[model samples]
Target: MISSVLPTYNRAPLAFVKGAGSWLETADGTRYLDLGAGIAVNALGHAAPVLVEALTEQAHKVWHVSNLYQIPEQQKLADALVEKTFADTVFFTNSGTEACELAVKMARKYWYEKGAPERVEIITFRGAFHGRSSAAIAAAGSEKMVKGFGPVLPGFVHVDWLDLEAVKAAVSEKTCAIMLEPVQGEGGIRPAPDAFLTALKQISDETGTLLIFDEVQCGMGRTGRLFAHEWSGVTPDIMMVAKGIGGGFPLGAVLATEAAAAGMTAGTHGSTYGGNPLGCAVGAKVMEIVAEPEFLAAVNAKGGFLRQRLEGLVAAHPEIFEEVRGVGLMLGLKCRLAPGELVAAGYAERLLTVAAADNVLRILPALTITEEEMAEAVSRLDAAATALETHLA
Candidate 1:
């Protein structure tokens, strides 16, 4: 362990030296079937030829230019995103946390512009993972994360997910918006009910509050669609996107309807590295590959297959896995054992999976993973479960 670096993350014992497609190779040449995909960032899988070629091609021509100048790549990516989604305007950031910060700022500023300066309270759900920024931490209201982090930011409220009555009761004259993850990723991979999302939209419309969807972990084809909200037929006033947007590179964005972004007229928000040429070029390439109709269809089919296999595993080992949850390739296995123990067992079996909130095992394979890789992941999972069951029994 590197003692110099902060011991913030509870990292696994092994270290991956390289990756290709759905596998990670350690220094000792041991290959592990990677289902987490760098926490769902590698949408195209590792070392995709197209992404490599595009990134390499752009590397020689130019890398970055200040956001002060015109960037054609940024415009192209933004135009493509706007064309496919309900967004009429867009802002770029370098990570999901920044995108989330922008979304929160935009929501409050929008209401302030409408002469409702008191409408600054933003309603967020109880198990939603927005990001790690101060504002995001405050919005999420996770006592575990917010503890000992000085005073929490003000004007944010938390409510029970999918409980319409609690949400209605929480909203007051000061409420400016409601934010949620369309498919909650860190919170045990629980997907918000379709009726609940639709109801939130209805309530937002009735109360004149903005609706923001944090699709950072679940968006960009992770859930077999450009955005998970599409599955529910609900369009958010402001949407935050990251993770798969840049493939393996770092990029995030906040897209919004025209009215919701009116307050962000020049100088309201800016980032030095946001929308630079290098990130934009790579992001454009990623968008080109993932935005295809056939690619999205394959993601859906693959996700269905993965879910079916996971359900079968649950049935076979009811003592280990309680339920399978989530949408598309972002599947989760509710476990009877401690999630960390399962992850450790998986590591010992040379399989890598992510642990999530609520003691669920997160299986977020690449959208481009093949059938054989899916089977291999399940096999390893079964082995790990059996090993743990023997120890526990």
Candidate 2:
């Protein structure tokens, strides 16, 4: 049968019919432990009681309204976000890509408002996945996403990761911002070094450029923190957040310091479904839950456990895994074979994982996952690795 949707993603064969906290049930009676959590978007896990209550309560009240009127829930969620992080203001969008678009725009606009309109160039890193949007694609300079699209948007410059001198040289009078993922999720789960993040902050300040963090995939407790930048002891002038913000609902936000957001006045930008009440209501609840000190600490402890187990697997099967790297639950295995083939093998073993750039297999689990579930995931990973080891041997 013909479908209206474009053929883009290489979808998995399984169609999940129901989910309950770290487990997915297929149309058949088969159930699979879900370590993927929809690629780290389901922070609180599937069918969470608190999230269900929030959604059910808000659904009866209101759903969609034009942005012409003030959205109280949006304000509430924004307030919670500001109270928890370095941001002073937030602009909501419907997805991570839209959040990225806003971050890029706000960075350039801030510089323009400061009387330097020529400073519009945005420096991004190689292997970064900002989004599929035109400007975001240009900012990412990803050949795979940009191909077949018409002329690329101008002013985005690319540099190699960890190349401080190249990053320094790339800056010019026209440079308005330096955008990078705190952890490169699609680029193979590579975490940026604390020193590199610190240097970017310093260089941005010295060059009078805005430092932008695309925390869309790595933020919102995925890194065992509210935001990954907090671990680096550095913050960006502008930050893009999404994925786990709504705890499975689609929501995204671009946060900025007051000075940085000054240019995003009423007429500068807008989105139709950006901050609908339902999404904001759910996000507000998610923030409230994730912000608890005990909850974050639990995530940290579980992340350590998961990583240690994965490291042991890597050590035991050196021929199958080169290394296991990443912080918190957003971990990866540098593999000896093709990442896609490995992901397939894991799936066949009733385990789910994602492939990324640099031939790494991603293991991004829900932050709220239990230690027992993590142990099971480790066991399944061990089985997958042993299978690969046998194949290679």
As for candidate 1, its clashing pairs are none
**Candidate with maximal lDDT:** 1
Q: TM-score for every candidate vs. truth?
A: 0.98, 0.98
Write candidate 1's Cα lDDT for 323-370 as tens digits.
999888989999987888889999888888899999999999989999
Candidate 1 C-alpha error for residue 316, in Å = 1.2
Clashes of each: 0, 0
Lowest summed-lDDT stretch of 10 residues in model 1? 1-10
On TM-score, the leading prediction is 1
lDDT of 2 by residue, 1-393 (tens): 656877677788888888989888888868888878888899999998999999999999999996889999999999999999999999999999999888888988888889999999999999999988999899889788788896999999999987899999999999999999999999999899999999999998898889999998899888888899999999899999999999999999999999989999988999999999999999999999998888889889999999998889889888888998888888999998898877877787787788889999988888888889889888888888888778877
> lDDT (0-100) at residue 32 of candidate 1?
89
